[model samples]
Structure formats: C-alpha cells, structure tokens
Target: MKVKRYVVDDLPQAVQMIRSELGSDAVILNTKEIRTGGFLGMFRKKRVEVIAAIDEASRKPAPRPAAPTKPIVRKSEPSEESAIPAVQLPNAAVRERYARSTGTSDAPAVRTSAVPSAASAVAVAVPAESPSKEAPERGAFAVPDDPRPARPVQAGAGLAENPDTASLLTELRSMKEMMVKLSKQQTFRSMPDSVMNWSRRLAEQGVEAPIIERFAEEVNDRLGTEGADDESAALSVAREVLLEWLLPSAGSGINSSTRIVHFVGPTGVGKTTTIAKIAADQSLTHHRTVGLITSDTYRIAAVDQLRTYADILNLPLEVVFSPSEAQRAFKKFEDRDLVLMDTAGRNYRNELLVSEVNSMLSPGEHAETILVLSMTQKYGDMKSVASQFAKYGVTRLLLTKVDETDSYGSILNLALEYSFAISYITCGQTVPDDIRPFDPNEWVSRLLGEPAYA
Candidate 1:
C-alpha cells in the first residue's frame, strides 16, 4: 500500500489532487479541517487535511504467459510386461488378510487385463530371488505398484506423518514469527535506545500510537541513525515536530466580532466556572462590557452558582428556561460589548441532548460555540462528547481541570483528531487567575519534560 497526506483548501480540491496523483483507485483514509500559516494564532488560513492510500499490488497488471513450444518425439522401444501386476488371492483367508493390510474391502473380484501374461505376474510376485526377513509375507497374491503421480498435500491438511506436510508446517510457523518481528521493527522497538526511550515517554504521557510513531519517524528522517542515538538531538527534533503540529490549533482566545459565546459540554466539566473566568477576563482585563446568561435551570444550584459570580463581579445575570426565553435574554444583552452564555451540562454523549442545547444558541458569524472539556476525563469519553458537539458545528475548545491530570497529550489528540482550536485552558478553580489563553510553546515544552510555568 502507498499512503500520502495532502493539505488543501477544500475536500473537492483534495479529491482532485488525490485522483491525479494516486489514480482513481485510491481512497481517502481520513480528512479534517486544519489551520496553518498564522502568527501567534492570528490570521491563520483554514485548510482541509486528507490522508489517502492505494494498494500498489492492485494497480499493477498481472504477467502474461509465454507462447507454447513444439513437442520433441522419439522412437518407442519394445515393451516388457508392465511392472504393475494383477492381484490373485488363492483363498478367502488370503483375501481377508490382503484387504486388512491395504485398508480395502474383502470383495472377491479380479481383473485379468492387469496381468499382461502369466509369466509377468509370476516374475513380479516372486521377487527375483528370495524375500528378506524384514519384508512382510505375501500369501499367494501380488500387490501392484500404482503408476499415477502422488497428489501434493496442501497446508493445514492435518497429515501428521507425511514429511512434506511437516516441512510445510515448519515453514508457516517461521513465516509467522518473521512477520511478527517485522511489525515490531516498524514501531518503536526498532529505534535507537535514545529515540526508543523518547517514544516510550510519549506513550506513557498518553500520546496515541500513530502520533508517537510519526514523531519517531520524523526524528529518524531529520537526523540520521547516529544523531537519533544522541539523546539531546532526538529530543530536539521531537519537540520541533510536536510544536509544528500544535501551533496550528492554538486559538486567539475570543474574537472581537463574537458578540455572544455559548459554553456547552458534558456534566461536571466546569462550564459555569469557565464562563465566569472568561466573563471576568473580558470585563476587567480587556475593559469590555460583559454580561452573563444562564440556561441551566435543570439544576437549581447551577443558576445560583452563576448568579453568585454575577453578584461578585457586579455584572447583570439573566436566567432563561427555554429557547424562546433565550432569545429575549440575547435581545437584552445586545447593548453589551460581549455576552457569555452558560449552558446546562448534560449527558452530551446523547446527540438528542446536544441538539437540544444547540437549538437555544443564536447562530451566525457573530456567535461562537465553545465545547468545554475536562482534562481528567478519559480520552474516549471526551472524544465522544466532542464528536456529538462537532455535529452542531462546535469547533473551538476550552479545556478545564488541567492540574487534575498528569498527561497533557489529550490536548494535542483533540486538536489533531478533531481539528478543534483550543481557545483556553483552566488549571484551577480560581475564577480569573487560573484561566488563560492556550500557549502552544508552553504546552509542547511541558509535554517534552521541559520545566514550564505553572
């Protein structure tokens, strides 16, 4: 199989390029929207990244056969009687013994044509001089040698005693062992000690297997075997590759034109706390007028919690129970510079609930939806929640509970797998102090075991 990756402006362009380069037989393995060529996560151009592959064996034509050659003929010699002789049992006991020895039925029948002449049958049965003691006794009957060629035994034919079958079984076992070794060599096992150590570190940090292999390959490709064996050189190249992958997904916090921001995620992910942090940042740090809206009527404490933050910040708070009431809240917050809306957290793994929450938000270029995820959650569960939100066009992410987890690879995993722009990350429960815009450099440094600012 031949595999290639293409980054293009759109899916149609990627399809056209794939067809032209890899032929029509090629298929797309995966595709996601990616941002590139931005300074400090500003003015980045959005592009579609596609992974395509084709089987080389399927594309090649089969070899044609050679033309037939004329046959060579020679004169025939006078035939002696055939080496095969007819079997003639003298009595019922002899016939039964012959049948038991040869694993055949004791049916009494004889073919005269098998014996070309009586002399030929006598010569074959008598065996030139005398029978050896090791040879079994033939009681007045001759066992004919079969002239047909032996059939080849296929693999897995269950012939335990056949030498050819045993040899084939040995070869199959050797092939399986060789294939397993080759597969191990393709992964981190074949890398130099230093490079392999780095790969193990990445895996221990929760990095996906494919991403780790790609990182090891990049290290080996950029630096040769000697350089890869050097710990410092391998670490340096791995850091560069990770930074290149992460920087593109770093977001610039909140856009100026985004008037309303909807914060949505699964239950217990700190959605309300994250909203309070963002609201405080916008109002105090940026000196912008900020308002708060909560649609979390499902839980009484949720509404009370946001209201407390509103009281502390001296900001107006609006509580809405339904989509119609949400529109009224938006109308009231139209005069404000920015409005951060807090949604009720639910089991967002259910698509129905996600769509229910999405219906309450205003959709337009001025509105943005942020899916807040907890870093301590399992990557599979987080992926499920993000996938549900992605159906509703939620592309920006705000990760919470960073200090609760030791591994940070899920941040990169979400960015690369779902193509989500990580807007902010909260490290603690502190409202404004713990939250900050995602910095790709700090994150990559921390991921690579470098000391970073807390």
Candidate 2:
C-alpha cells in the first residue's frame, strides 16, 4: 500500500494526484491525518493523507526504473509480513508484483468474493453494489489496513502484516514534494533567495518528478532571460511578479457606478485610519472632492479620527449609527467625486453584522468595496478574512504595512487564486508619503531573480 500527504486545500488535488500516479485501477485504501512536523519533531497540521495501492500486485517491474536520485534515504521495506527488510521499494506495485510473480506467498492477494464487487480494483468494501459496471468505487473502505485488492501475507522473517508502514514512507516523500512545490510557488511570487535554495535542498531529497520539473521551469525562466539586469530592475520586477500573482480582474461584484469606498476588516487592522489616508490622498493630491463617512459609532473616538482629517481639509464628515443612516450619509456625498466610508471592525465570521455594514456601503453607482488587508497579519487569518469579506462584495484590495512582513506568501496565494487589483500599498500611517502606487514592472523583476530593493 502507498500513502501520500498533499497540502492543497481540497479534494480535486487528491483524486487527480492518484490518477496521475497509481493508474486507473489504483484502489484507495484509507486517507486521514498527518503532522506537518517541525524542528521539535512537530505538531499535527491535519493534512489529508491518501492511502492508495494498485489492485494488481506488481504486474511487471515498474515501467520506469527507479533513479538513485541523491542523498541516501533509508526506509524499512519488508518483502512480506514477518519477512526480512528489503531495499527501498520503488513503487508499491513493483515490489508487491515481484513477490506475486516470483511465486512467493509474501504478497497479499485479492479475492473477488471478499471485496464488494462495486469496488472492483478499489476494495473499499462498499456495502451497496454499484448500479453500473463502469463506475465502481473502491473508496468506500472502512479498514485502515484494508487491502488494495485482497489477500493475506503475514508469515515471513519479520515484516508484520501492518498495511500502514509502507504508506507512511511514501507519504513522507509526497510531503517533501508538496513542500518543494510550495517553495517554488513562493519563490516565483516573493523571489526570496532563501526559498530558492531550500527548493534546491529539497530536490536533493525525494520530492516528486513532475513537481521538480515545474520548479525547474520557474528557476530556468529566472536565469535564462537575456540581458536582464538584476539590481536596478528589482523594484519593477518585484511589481510584475506580484502582479502575476494578482492578475487584476475586470471588476467583480463591485458596482463602479456607486462611489462609496468602504474599508472593513478585522479589528485592529487600521481600517479607520487607512480610510483617512485614502480620503486625504484623494482630496488633497488628486484634487477630488472627497467626502468622509464613518459608521464606526460603536467604538468610542472612532469618529474623532475621521473628523480630525475632515477638520484639516475642511471636508464634510458623515457620522451614521445604522446601516440606514450610513446609506443616507452616502446620499449626502453623492455629488462628491469620491466618498470614503469607514465601518467599525468586527469579527469577520459575524455574517449578520458584516452584511449590514456591506449593505450600507453598497456603492450607488461609482464606489467599489475594497477590503483593506494588513501585510503584518497572519496568512491563514488573512485568507479567512478574505473569504469572509468576499461575501460582502469585495473585489478590489488595498494592502497595508508593506514594510512590515518579510514573508508575503499569503499575498501570492490571494493574487493567484483571487482576481483582485491592488489599488495601492501603504507602509506607514502617513497619508501621502507612505502610500506607493501599485506597479507591475517592479513585481515581475523580483519574481525573476532580481535582488531586493533598498
């Protein structure tokens, strides 16, 4: 049996992975948990472990000969239950097939009678038979040690009849593959030299071949570009690479006809302050008549922040208590070129409150709901926040604290997966100087091996 750990968030990766691997008849035995181990031998990350095996014990030696890749890796491979340890088994099919073909009873067998017929090569022992012959599902097995096909091969020198031992080793290798891909994805996105080297080190270990190829392609693209200056082009390339991750959209659910730009996110995310910055930038520099509306009535002194900016610029400030009041405030700003609305930060999962706030800031015809994300925030937390606000009609994004985080992997994830234009980035609380324009040339250079900027 073979098991593999994949870090992707969903199941398509698991199924496509099995098909790309063990072939059509590969029977999935069991799938469950894994600990993404760390320096202290690590904690569990609850990743899904796929336990799969080919139904036919090695038919012929694996069509592809095993490569003596690099860095000696040792794992216990038992030929049969209670048997002596064998050399590293290339694929479960190869070793098991060898045992079966060599007339050795060490290999387990499949009994047509034992495994539910519906399961076919995948012997999950589904109690219900498949209505059709072509759609047999072997994924329904309840036993963790369930056989891919059949049999009993538990009498040998020392190899116990444990089904998980072999799968665990394979899964470890698979995890190495996933980590390598993750490093590659991050490298192309962040261009962190350290990650590129880590990818090299993992390659010396046992990451999968296809994953290696894709990573190699990214690295090759970096080096092969002709006349590409690294040092000076840093900013431009960084922007381009980041944009590739972002791949801006044609506008999502946001209605441009509405001119209300609402900044809402988790508490302590600088939502109110950032709104002040954008409002000032637009009013002072862009020469646009910016109107300020605050719906953060719950938090004391929230209005003070926006009011301070309004006082300095002589811009009108709208303080609203209810979503209905917020709507009326938007009406007052209807004639202004830009309306910057600030909402009280709340628990993102508090859908009821978010919906109410979203309803208030709903652009009449010119405003776009742009979620403000802090670079200093944790990636998982950021993803959750993004998902939560996604339901609130957020289509554009404004990244804050560019100077804060060194590892921006989550930014890459959001850009690649979600089509959101990063309108601007702010490094500090300063309204004008801290805010920088979003440029793609800088993004691409950084992605293609440019050095970090000063």
Candidate 3:
C-alpha cells in the first residue's frame, strides 16, 4: 500500500493532490493541521494535512474456510485423592492375576491414573467445559494416555495396562510445563476505543497515521517523566511557537519611532475594532498620543464602528474613502507618535481588493500594514486570505476570535512554512483586555494542542 501525506488549506485541493499522487484505490488514513511559520501561521496560511494508504488485500481473491475441531477421552484414575502418580506399561495385562500370591492388604495403596491415550485426553479436556468461567463441558481437555488394542485383557480391567499410554502421558505433562513458562514473557493488548476519533481528527487536518503512531509510542515511553527539566523544556518550546505570532508587543518591521500602523483583513474580521483597541492601549497604557483614521467605504457601518470607539476615547477620527483621502489623512496626523489606520477589509482572493489595499500605504508613507485574520476561518480559507493579502504590503498579522476555536494545530504549520509575524490575538468581544500582544511561548503552548497555560 502506498501511503502519503499533504498539507493544504482546502479539502478539495487536498483530495486532488492525493489523487494526483496516488491512484483511486487509495484509502485515506488520517488528516491534521498544525500551525506553523509566523503571524499565527499567516505565512503558511491555514494548513490541512491529509494522509492516505492503498488497500492491497482487496486485489486478491478470497480463500476457502476451514473445518471445526471436536474432543475425545482416554482413561481414569485409580484414586482421585492420591498425590503420587502411577506408571503403567503399554499392552500390559488388564490386571495381575494373583494365585493367592503377593498382594498388599492392611490398607490398600491409592493408585492415581490418567487416560490411556493423548488424543482422548485432548478431546475429554476440551469438550467437558462449556467454554465459560464457572461451568465446563464433559471431558474437555481431559484425555491422558492410550492403551494397546491388540493386548489380551481381563474381564473387569480398564485400559490402564497399556505401557505406551503411560509414556504418552509423561510427555504431555512436560509440554504443558514448557507452555506455562513461555506465556509469562509475552505482552497482552486490548483494542483502543478512541482510535476512530483520533484518526478522524488527524485525517481532517491532513496528518499521516505514521507520524501519529510514532508520537503515540513516544508518549508511552515518556508517560511519567514530569521532572522540573522536562517541564522547563516543554515550556521553552511552547514559548518559541507562540513567539511566531507577530503581535505588536513582539516587534516587527517598524521601529517604535514610527507613527503610523494600519489594520487590514477580510470583512467582519474585527480589523477596525482591533485597531481602536490598540490605539486605546497606546493612549492609556503606554501614554503615547495616538490618532485614528477609517478608510472603510465598502460597508455602511464600518466607519460607524470606528467612529464610536473614537468618540469614547476622545480620539480624532478621519474618514478616508479613497487612496487620495488616505494620503491626506496621513499628512494630517504626520506628527502624532502613533497613528492607527482602519482600512476597509480586503478579500485576499479579490485581485482588485488586494491592489487597493497595497496602493494606500505603498508610496511616500511610514505606515506599516497589519493583516487582521480570523482564527475560526478554515485552514484553506485562511491560506487564501494570506496569499491574497501578501501583495497588500501587510507587515505583520493580527489574529482575532482566538477563544472561539478548539483546535489550533493549523498555526504550527503556518509559522513553520511562512515567516509572517503575529502582532496580537483577541479572545473576547471586549476592547483592550480581549486584545493582548502576542507571546511566542504562550502562543506555542496554545498551538501545541493545549490551553494557553504552562
């Protein structure tokens, strides 16, 4: 079977990639997406990784079924309570006919015996049990030894006179003893209950089964290693992953001396809201004099949203409906320590939208474009947003609606694949507090498939 893995933003593209590489007989094994690169995986976009394998078993024909097994019996014991065993010869006489000769009297010695043949012993021992815990069938796994058929026998005697039967019983005891020792060294396993769920999650995101199996093995080996050093190492890796975000607190292409930073993203991604929050942070927390400008003419309430935030903070609001208007607005706030522009959300897939966003801050301006992306967007859609907006001169990325999604695996692959810096993440609808600066370590912890805590 040919098993392969791929990471993309969309399911159709992912499936197409798989079919192009492997044939139609391929069976999907798993899918998973881990965030990577930077700017909350703004670089690689949202990735959906898929793993598939071929089914070789179906290529050949089926085989015929086999028959079932039954049981048998052999001989009996002289005394069931006797501890010492008796040794009997094969084809021997049924009983020693004493002509009033040497026979023990006082208290007759107890004689323990087994079936005269191994075949009968196997049958009787197996069939006697009902194949249950408490009760069993008749003579199941009970056969012991077999006696010679051609021997002359006494009237009332059983098959205990067979010497060969006695020898066969001795060999069975030795084999059973060996089997007991071997069973102790082997490992026992039960089927897992959540295999399908785990597999489905991985399959949906495009992670290969082989990698998951390897991780499972490692987790088993390190199940109980919760030392200080291990904790520290895990935290360190997490921090680094979180650092991949380009939140303004993490620093980006612009220096602190720059006065203008712009926010851009798809419609309804809270770009204007996030920009106002950042501006408020600068004015209240950092004590930096900040100004706000809105260039969102495509939607009716887009400017209204920014206007309300500006009104609450007593901050100046400039509405720019075109590129020329944006340039004039920049000139008006040229002296401010920080000027945050809220551009109309630009669909990265729309060529005209990406072009318009790029033109506003591309020439004769100190503005740094910050791309605001949604965390809830599917991986492929996220990628499309990133790819389209890249040409719009977005200097860093801002991720909104962080608390709404459960899986953050797409972030890892994005950071690893792209170098975009993440500026901030918003976990709630509130201003300021909901929007916090990005921390690589903290983000990586979240990206590592855990809540944002040590």
For each candidate in turn, the TM-score is 0.61, 0.50, 0.48
lDDT, model 2: 0.59
Candidate 3, residue 252: lDDT: 45
Predicted candidate 3, C-alpha RMSD: 22.1
Q: Of the candidates shown, which would achieve the greatest lDDT relative to the real structure? A: 1
The per-model lDDT (C-alpha) reads: 0.80, 0.59, 0.60
The worst-scoring run of ten residues by lDDT in candidate 1 lies at 67-76
Model 3, C-alpha of 397: deviation from truth (Å)? 0.8
lDDT of 1 by residue, 254-324 (tens): 98878999999988999998888888889999889998999998876998999999999999999998999
lDDT of 2 by residue, 1-454 (tens): 4554445445667778878877767766776666665667666455666767775565355664333232231222422232222222223453365455556655443322232222232222222332232322222112222234455645641223445766676788899999988986775655445334534433443333444345544544564444133433433433433444445632332233446677877777788767777676677776788788888877788889779878888899988887688778877776887788788888776678667677776554565677888878876677787887787557688778877755444454566556566777777877656876666555433334346542
Candidates 2 and 3 compared by TM-score, better number: 2
lDDT of 1 at 143: 43
Candidate 3 C-alpha lDDT tens digits along 90-152: 212212311122352222222333443333421111222223333222212232333333455
Give the better candidate number (1 or 3) by TM-score: 1
List candidate 2 segments past 4 Å from native: 1-216, 221-258, 443-454
Error of 2 at 40 (Å): 51
